[model samples]
Target: MSVANSVSEISPRPSIEGIVEITRADMDRVNALILSMAGSNVELIPQIAEHLISSGGKRLRPMLTLASARAFDYSGEGHVKLAASVEFLHTATLLHDDVVDESALRRGRTTARMIWGNQASVLVGDYLLGQAFKMMVEVGSMRALAILSNASAVIAEGEVWQLSAAKKMSTEESDYMAVIEAKTAALFAAAAEVGPVIAEAGEPAIAAMRRYGMALGLAFQLVDDVLDYGGSADALGKNVGDDFREGKITLPVILAHRHADAAEQQFWREAMEGGSNDDEALARAMELMARHGALDETKHRARAFGAQALEALDALADTPVRSALADVVDFCIDRIN
Candidate 1:
C-alpha cells in the first residue's frame, strides 16, 4: 500500500496529555542525579557531554523508568538511581548516533559532534557508557547490571546492523523491525523492566511493562520516520528530508519503494545512491509515495504499535503513572517537532 492510502484507511486516535506532571521533589532528585552522573574529570569530555546532556530533551526514557516504578507502587528512592542510569545510557547512544549519522542538529540545537568534533563526541559517548555501568554497579543489583548490559549490547549490534544496511534496496519490513527493536526498543524495554525488577515485582508484571516499553519504542521510531518526511524543520529540530539525504531507508520510504514499479524503483535507486537533492527528483519521489500509500501504511503500523502499548497498560491499575504512560504513546505519534 502507498503512504497516503495507508493513512486514509485508519481513523486518527484521540490525543492524550499530562506526561510531565511528576512531583517537584521527584523532578529535583532525578535532575540532581543526572547532573552528578554526567559530571566528569576530563574537562573536554564533560564539556562535550554537557553539550548534549544539558540540551533540552524530553527525557522520555528516564520518565519511563520512573513511571514504571511508580506504577508498581514503589515508594523507595532507588528509582532515582535507575532513572539516572537509563538517562546516561540514552545520552551515550545519542552521542554515538550523532557521530555515526554526522548529524549537525538535535533537539533544535547543534549536536555535540557539530560543536566539538567527532573524536570528542565518540570519546565522551564511551565515557557516558562507562559511567552508566558504574552507576549500575552502585545500584548494587546484579540483575540491574545484567539487564542494562544486555540492552547495551543489543543497542550496539543494532547500530552496526543499521550502518551495514544503509541504502540497501533489498531491506524489508522484517529487517527494519529487527533493527528498530534492537536499537530503540531494547533500551526502552530494559528501562521499564528495571522498575518492576527493583520493586521485586513478579515476572508477569515485569513482562507487561517490557511489552509496554517495546511497543512504545516501536511507535516512537515509526512516527519519527514519518516526521522525517512530513514534519516541519523547527518542530523536528532538523531539516525535513534529512533522512533521505543521508540515504537511510526508514519505514515509510521502504514501504513505498516496495510497491513502486520498475521505473519508480529506479527513481528510488538513483535517489538513494546518487545523493541528488534536486527538488524535482524529491517531489517525484514524494508523489510516488503518495500514490502508493506507503506513508499512510507506515502511519498505520505506528498507530497499531501505539495501541499495543496502551493494551500492555491493562495489567496495571488505573493511576496517574499509567495515564501518563498512555499519554506518552500518543505524544510520540502526534509530536509535530
Candidate 2:
C-alpha cells in the first residue's frame, strides 16, 4: 500500500506531549544555552549552526536527558548543562552526517552543506563538538564527562564503519545493528546515563536509563529507515528515498536483499553502486521492499526494541516522567504508521 493508505489504516500514533510538557522548563534553559554556544566570532559559524538547530525536528535526545534527571528527582543545574551538551553532540552529528550522506534536505529544508558548502558544515560540526565538551566539563562530573566523551569517539568510529560498509552487499544485519548502536544509540545511552549519574543515583538506576535510551535509539532509527521507503517528505522532515538515493544500506535494504531473487539482487547491486536512482528506480525499490515484506518486518523489529525500552523503564518507579518516556518509544515507532 502507499504511504497515505498505510497512515489511514493504522491506529492513532503516540505523541511526545507528555514528556514535552514535563521537560519544558529544563528544555528552555537547554535551548538558550544551545543558542548562545552555537554563536561564534566567525560570522559563518552561527549562521550555519542556527539554521540546522532551528529546523523543525524535535530535540528529543537532550529532552531525554532532562526527563531522565527529572525522573530521578534531581534538583540541580548540572542536568541543564549536560542536557545542552547532549544537544550539541546530536546537532554536531547531524551537521557531519548530512555532509557524509551527501544529503540535500534535512528536516524539510535545504541542508547546511547544500547552502554553505561541505567545508563550512564540517568545521561547524567540529565547533559544536568543542562546545559539547566544554559544557560537559562545566558539569564537573568525571563520570558524565567519560560517558559523553566516549560516546563522541564511538560515534566517529561508527561513521567510518558505515562509510566502509556503504553499498557493499556483504554488509549483514548484525553489521547494520552495530552501526546504528554506535552512530545513533551511543549518544542516546550517554545522554540518558549522564542524567542519573549527575543525580548520583545508584548503579541500577543508571544502567536502566542507559538501556532504555539504547533501545529507544535503535527503534527510532529503524523507523527512520522504514520511513525512507514508506513515508513522505512532509511527514518525515527529510526527502523520501534518501537512503536509496544515497546507497546507504539500512534494515529494509538488508532484509529485501537477503530474500531477493537473482534479478532483484542485481537491481540492488546496481542501485547501491550509484548506477540506478531515477524516479522509476525509486518506485521499483519501494515495490521490491513491499513485495518482500521488508518494511513490515522492519517495523516488527522496531516494536520489539520498543518493548525492550519499556521493559528497561520498569526498573524505575512508576512516575509521570517515566510514563512519558515510555510514550516516546511509541511515538518514535508510530511516526510512519
**Top candidate by TM-score:** 2
Once superposed on the true structure, which residue ranges of model 1 sit more than 4 Å away at CA?
A: 1-17
Candidate 1 global lDDT: 0.84
Q: Which tens-of-lDDT digit does each residue in 1-337 have in candidate 1?
A: 9999999999765343355675345657888877787777778877887778778777778878877888888877878888888888899899999889989888888898888899988888888888888888887878878998999999999999999888787888899999999999999999999988888888999999999999999988888788777787775667777788788888888889888889888888888776764667777777887898878888889999989999999998898878888888877777732
> What is the lDDT, from 0 to 100, of the residue 285 in candidate 2?
89
Q: Each model's number of backbone clashes?
A: 11, 0
Question: Candidate 1 at 79: error in angstroms?
Answer: 1.0
Among residues 3 or more apart in sequence or in different chains, the pairs in candidate 2 whose N, CA or C atoms overlap within 3 Å are: none
Tell me each candidate's TM-score: 0.92, 0.95
Ten consecutive residues with minimal summed lDDT in candidate 1? 14-23
lDDT against true structure, model 2 = 0.91
**Per-residue lDDT for 142-193 in model 2, tens only?**
9999999999999999999999999887799999999999999999889888
